[model samples]
Structures are given as C-alpha cells and as structure tokens.
Target: MSEKPISKGKRSVVITGASRGIGRALAHLHAAHGFDVLAVARNFKDFPHHPNITCLPLDLTWSDAIPKIIGCLNATARPFERLINNAGIQVELDLTRDVGDETPALIDREIALNLTLPIHLSHAMVPLMARPGGTIVNVTSLTSRQPKSSAPVYSATKAGLASFTSALRHQLAPLGIRVVEAVPPLVDTDMTLGRGSGKLSAEAMAQAIYDGIAAQRRIIAPGLSRPVLLLNRLLPELVAKILAKS
Candidate 1:
C-alpha cells in the first residue's frame, strides 16, 4: 500500500519492537532528540510515557496488519525520517531433535517477524520517507554472518535480511534514503536470557546503532560482532570450527 505524502513538520520515526530492549532504547534516543516517535509493539504497559511518543499496539506477525499500520502513519501526517525494523523471534530448538507439533508454526512466525515484516514495511514506507535525509535501519544479527546449529531458521532469516538491506540500499541511494544494516552480537535482552556470555547491553548496542547512523555507516557491527565478522572473513574455516563447537 502506498502512503500519502507526509506533511513537512516535526521529524518522526517508526520503530517496531519498541516495548523493550534495543527497540525501546532507540525510541527513547529519538524522542530525547526531539523527534516524534511511533512505537509499535504488542504491549506498552511498561513503556515510558512521553509526549513525543505514540504507542501503537499491534502484532507484526499478522501479514494483514501491514496496511493498517501504514494507514495509521498516513493519518498522522508526520514526515518519516527513520524506520527501525527491530522486531524478531528466535526458536532455539535443534531441528535434529524429536520434532514437536509446534515446530512448524514457530518456524513460520520467526520467518514472518524477522524477514517478511521488514521487507513489507520498507516497501510501504519508501515513498513517504524524507527525500534527502531519511534512513531505514534493519537490525540483523551476528548469526547472519555465521549460522548457529540450534537456530538455523533464525540465522537464515537474518542473512536474508542482510541481503535485502544491501539491495534496498543501492536502489534507494538515488532518492537519498540511507539503508543501514545493524549487526549486533549477543545482547543482554530477555530474548537471550542465559544464552551467551560477553554480550553487550541493550543500551550500549543502541548507542552504537545511533552513532553508526549519524556517521552514515552502511553496516553497523557493534561489540563482539565486529571481531566475529572480521574473523569470519579472514579465517573462514577457523571461524566455522569455533562456531561448530559452540
């Protein structure tokens, strides 16, 4: 669906998964900077109330909800300066194990949230984005660079998003929209509770993303993700062996 032209006024940002973790941090950062924020999440009972923030409670997994989201944005008449696609889910079940009844449903949900939603939202917002300074940030993961054994579907979805972001970047460059890929390592969010060590805090990761966007970095790899990416590039086999052991 095409969004109507937004009126020129206060810069606005739309962030998915804004109820917690990195998404919450990004919403606060933008709001603090005086930008109006459209924070989309399933629940906002604990979200900080802010004058510049509008909470939109919605489930992103429902493909039919995309049009309603865009319609809401159009009705707001706020010029879009940024769109952060940060909502995602990971099922940590090993595919080789005894399959459960819910495995297929979980896989579909993961793919929809991690990959399809972002692509659809971006497509809908491209025409409404600010011509000269708009930005779209896709929050990918280190797993995209090197897949994990337990969450193969999550890893594949992230890798697909990375590629989509790359292509979208080139396609949108002529119109001056910046497409940014944010690759973060294990983060200390509820999503990764008790999963990995040496994880970066959500606040720290958000700061890195903000700084990287300000600097117009095409790819933002914060904390351990940076070294992990470099190692994967320089010594593929060594990285593969290490990941295999993990």
Candidate 2:
C-alpha cells in the first residue's frame, strides 16, 4: 500500500534562531514547503520580509521574553503547528578561555539556549501544539553523540537536548504531539564557520529535518551524526576516546 502523504497546510511553524545558518535555512525550506512561518532570531535585520514568514527578534537567553513573543504571535493569529528549536551559538571554540575566566558565561549561555529556552517555549506551546499531528524538531549536534574535547560545553548542551527530546516525546506522544530530535553533523554554517573538519551542507541538514517532520521520526541524524549515534550506542567508550583525539 502507498504511504499516506503528509498533511500540508501552511505548515504553520515556529523556528528559533532563524537569522542565519541552519535556522535560516529551515525557515526558507519550510516556506518552500508551503509553511506559514514565525521565524525568531536575535534581531530582525538578519531576517527577510518573506510573505510566508514573520520575524520575531529577541535574545532567547533572557527567557523572560518568550511568553511575550508567543503572546504577540497569538494576538496576531496563531500560525504555528510545529515548533523548531533550531537556534544555537557556539562558545566552546574558545575552549582555552578557562572556567573562572569565562566558562561560567559559556555554561550559562548554552543551558539557556540549548536547554532552558526550548523547554520553556515547548511548555508554552504544548497546549497549542499537542493536540493532533503537531510536531517539534530540536536541532541538536553530532557532538552529542561523539563528545569532542575541543567543544566540551557544546557537547554537553547537545546531550542535554537529546535527552530532553526523548523525554518530551514520551510525555507528549499520548497528546498527539511528536517531539523530534534533528541531530545534525557538522554543517557549513556561520556557527560552524572555520570549525568542523568536514561539513554537511545546510541544505542537507534542512532536508533531514523536513523528512523527520514528514515521517514523524523521533530522531533524525544526518550524515556523520548517524554513524556517531551508532558508535555511541555500540561502543560509547571507544567513540569517546576517538573523539577526544580528533
């Protein structure tokens, strides 16, 4: 039998960190897929005035502004059936910066963006999205599966997100909302600029997220992320050691 097609109708999605990189790519891709989107970023200047998209610029690390932004969107008209937590920044590249020096800031920032923001935002949108056929895709990292010594904090943040996604899926599955983890390998984006030995194209990662949403796949790992997940499952210690050396 042929599979049922994805029910498309102005996908009605909310994607964070939409100014550039994977987040920006996702916004464009979703629009191309006929989604009416609310794209949030650090500032509106980085976003374009697309007919299908509404740009909401605010630093999510603050955490206090999320409800207000959601309220604004709701006041205008709720056009979000899916919430893509795709916004993130990398502070670990400056790894040698040291703990007492700036590690606290890095740790705090990662938790805010990678963990707290998404969790709070998800909670806010649950009633709106957890009804039926609703979806959520969290943009995670290959480092979650393969711990890189160079980016210790980034890996921790991704790992936390991975765990959160699974737990969220379990909690919201019965409610009909699909919480998915879009695990991406290294991508050629500003965040990964000048970093990551080999890079997966942003388009590739975007397609993976789209496919995951279409299929309601709980975990979508593209390119090296897939292999990394496998190794993490089969030989975690070996993978950890290998990653440390890389």
What is candidate 1's lDDT per residue for 162-207, written digit by digit as tens? 9999999999999999999999888999999988788888889888
State the lDDT of candidate 2 residue by residue for 1-246, as single tens digits. Answer: 111222334458888988888888888899787877777777766465566777776788885668866775566544358899988876655556573766787688877888788888988888766377889888888777776676677788888888899999999988888899988877998877777577888887888898878876778988887888888899999888877766
Candidate 1: misplaced stretches above 4 Å?
A: 1-8
Location of the lowest summed lDDT over 10 successive residues in candidate 2: 1-10
What's the residue-level lDDT of 40 in candidate 1?
86
Give the CA lDDT, 0 to 100, for residue 185 in model 1: 85
Candidate closest to the true structure, highest lDDT = 1
Q: If candidate 1 were superposed on the true structure by all CA atoms, what would the RMSD be?
A: 3.4
Candidates' lDDT values, in order?
0.87, 0.78
- C-alpha-based local distance difference test score of model 1: 0.87
